[model samples]
Target chain A: MKISRIVSLVIVLIAASYFLVPLYATFQFSLQMLRGQWSFQAYRSVFADPNFLSTLSYSAVTSLVAILISTLIVVPTTYWVRLKMPRVKPVVEFITLLPLIIPPIVIVFGYLRLYGSDSLLPLTVSSAGTNLMLVIGYATLSLPYVFRSVDNGMQTLDIRTLTEAAESLGANRSTIIFRVILPNLRAAIVSGAFLTFSISFGEFVFASLLNRPAFGPYLVQIGQDRAYEPAALAVLSFALTWACMVLMQIFANAKPGASRRRRGAAFNPLARRKTA
Target chain B: MTVADDLLNPPSQGGSARSAPAGLPGAKAPRRANWAWLGLLPFALFAAFFLILPIVYLVTGAFQTPEGTFTFDNLIALTGPAILGSYWLSIKLSLVSALLGAAAGLLLSWALVLGGLPRWVRGAFITFSGVASNFAGIPLAFAFIATIGRLGIVTVLVRELFGFNIYGAGFNLFSFWGLALTYLYFQLPLMVLIITPALDGLKTEWREAAESLGASHAQYWRMVALPVLSPSILGCFLLLFANAFGTLATVYALTGSQFDVVPIMLFAQIRGNVLYNPNLGYALALGMILIAGLSNVLYLVLRSRAERWRA
Candidate 1:
């Protein structure tokens, strides 16, 4: 028993080191920008670059838009599939999973081919159109995750009961979806949105291929030329990814009613009249 | 089980949402059923425009000539030595990383789940795995480079501490093995996240039964535990393989244009730089899709078979 425990400890320690060593090395290397002293000079240099702020903000805004688009598409489809059309569940699920099989580079390649300047409904003709296409591409990439997250969330609820209850109170389909269903799905949507945000924020192939000034391309550009700054940027990017995961974990673990109560009561007719 | 299984599994076993509105007039039922598919329009449009249409475009383009005439020349060009070598290297690299990542991750998961570790250790590792699994692409490459590059800290530490020069011993961090090692940064965590559940599903009674039947530990593992775990393990390995195969930014950042991974070659083709063959890029993309798709299909099959154990 003691020997087994010791073996387990050794294995855990080795795995932990594999996960931690690179992060530790990167953080230390980022601090070595000064000639002979540990410093934040690399981070300072990175922060001072205007391109850093610009590209990050651009990616942030674009990712947010993509998240919104993904949510708007996924939540409704999942709701409808569960509540109204269970027969088409297979089709919806297949479409959602298609993104996983088709690599992003290939998807983006297809986008350039089908939506190029010469094509009908040419989305890549103008900068704005191209940005729109980029957002759409991001939405496509995130479809599987958002769909699964939302579907998992929906599974926890008795959708038929909720919808029927809402309908009995004279609520229309849109009102029930916007109020009751959306409120209940808040946690799921937020987690999915965070995942989407993280993915799109540092997405390289789509943003780079579309010639967008996104954070991923900027990171790669810096990685090509700079040394310490790239390390600092890596640390920063990891922190961003860590932040997203932590936020996702928090929201995912939150009790369904913890945050949903207020929104549900505000929009729910039965609760509104009873509270009044 | 995978999300595919979760989705195909009926959402509610007893409370069929479609039956809820049965109190309505008989005429309304058929009309409602017909109109139900309209709710799927927005999602269907998005999928068609963004996902399906683009892929269909590429599949068709792969068979066309430069002037839009039909030709098999592009697909035939994929057989050239350079392109074939790129595909070969990619397959070998992905296979190596996936196999190593799966073995290491399975060991770690087993150590955590069945090796009698404290509960908090498992929790912390799972949380870390969640972060690390998603922490891929360009930043990941930089992290590896910072750790093991020519002037990296590990290299320097090993040199100063033990007088052992790694790069001097031809331990190039920009080569195939280096990239495979780096791929593990994400792949290992992904395997942990996926395989942990399967590990958890291994009931204690199975081991107890094996012991009561006069089986040794190795016999128990080989005769009982491994057979049940094999499907899930193989499925997860395939998932890891597909994940590593499609990776682009990490390899591109680490090796630059020098390394001829198919994705890099495709990137150059799309960029119209050194390789200006768009139709050939289509074929390459098609090959990638087929490989990823084939693995995923096998994973789904394996997952469904693994479900019997879960039940």
Candidate 2:
């Protein structure tokens, strides 16, 4: 047992090293000032350029806008399906989840065919609407994660009670939805929003196909046109992605504990044995 | 997984909720948006417009001639030599990458779940995996450039220090093996995420009990843990296969369309001027979608099997 464990430990370390090499090397390359010297020139070069910063910021704005739109679509739909028309839950779920199941290229191909040239609709290439469509694609990319999380959250809460309580007080429909249900499902919303933001921020497919002024295309341009600088930018992208992913894991993990808390309070002793 | 499982139980759910409200019952649902599905309509609309309709056009158009006659020429062209070679290559690449990813992920998950690590270290590994996994298409290609490209840092350093060029050593990144290696960056981490839960599901008691019963470490793992984790390991492998099969962005960025893997070839046929047969491209896409659909069907079957086991 001891010998096997030692072997496993050694193997794990080697795999870890293999997995982390590109990350470490990218950092190493980025930190070099002279040919072999350690310096912050890469960081300076990245920040010194207005184009890079503007493009990254532009990508961030798209992500946020996409998140807002997703929230607008997902939250109410999820809430309504759970509370009233529970039958359509599967259809809603299917539509939202289809993007993940389909190959991204197929979807992107579909996008280009539908809007790319003078074929289908009145499509202005690279217009704001084009950018908006990119966000819509991103939101679709993230729908599964958000929908699952929020739908899970809705299951744990006493929605009927909360709604009745609010309605009895003469709160309007919009106020009840925006103020009450949204607040309860906040964590899932944050998780979904953050997921959309991270994915959209790193998105390459729609952004590239659409030729939008986004971080993905910007990185691609930097890599092909200017290799070393793109390495430095890749490090920056890695850091941003690393941070957001941790936040996502934290959200996914907390879900179980949160549901347990709600159920614990609601379940009587009889229900405990029944559940167990 | 909680919601994912619940959604899978279609029999327990309602039917034809097209315009019905599915939220809290306090608010009466006779309003315009509140009639049934106010918020979800836009997303469904979004899916239909961008995701559904385009694919409908792209795939359906494959069956028609350029002048509008429905025909199987596009589908027939799928079995041609050029396409058959590329399809075989794409499937081969997908299988190799997914299996390689599964092996790497099994090790990584062992380190993550059972191998002891400090909270911060575990946190870092998990975070790094998520970022690295999601960091698939664009930035990964960029990182590989700095680290592995012909004039990349490692290649350059190899020349100056040891007078050995890895590219000259026949480790090319612009070829088949190169594309596979690039894919490992995303595939391995994703497999780790998917397989970790299954590894975690393995009971430590079983290992300890097996050991105390005079079983060797190999016996404990081979007879006990491997069997226990086999379903997830299998499911995750297929998921990775599906993922790699459909991938467009990473390989495209790495080798351009010079590689001519199925997705790239399909993209070239439809989108690239060089391949002017859009109908043929649609037929290729149909094949791709059929494979994707098969994988999902496998997921459903396996997922239900998972439920049965638990039950």
Best by TM-score: 1
For every prediction, compared with the true complex, DockQ reads 0.38, 0.34
TM-score, candidate 2, is 0.84
Off by over 4 Å in 1: A255-276, B1-29, B273-275
Error of 2 at B95 (Å): 1.2
- Per residue, candidate 2 scores C-alpha lDDT tens digits across B1-311 of 13323222221133335223544343322333343443456766877887789879877887988787999998898899999888999899999998899998888778767766545655566556666667777777767876888877777888999999898789987777877888888777777766665676677788899999999978998999887777767777777787788777677778777887888887676556444677777788888888876775575456556544333
Q: Chain B TM per candidate, please?
A: 0.89, 0.79
Docking class of 2: acceptable
Clashing pairs in 1: none
Candidate 1 achieves a global lDDT of: 0.82
Query: For every candidate, what is the interface RMSD in angstroms?
Result: 11.0, 10.1
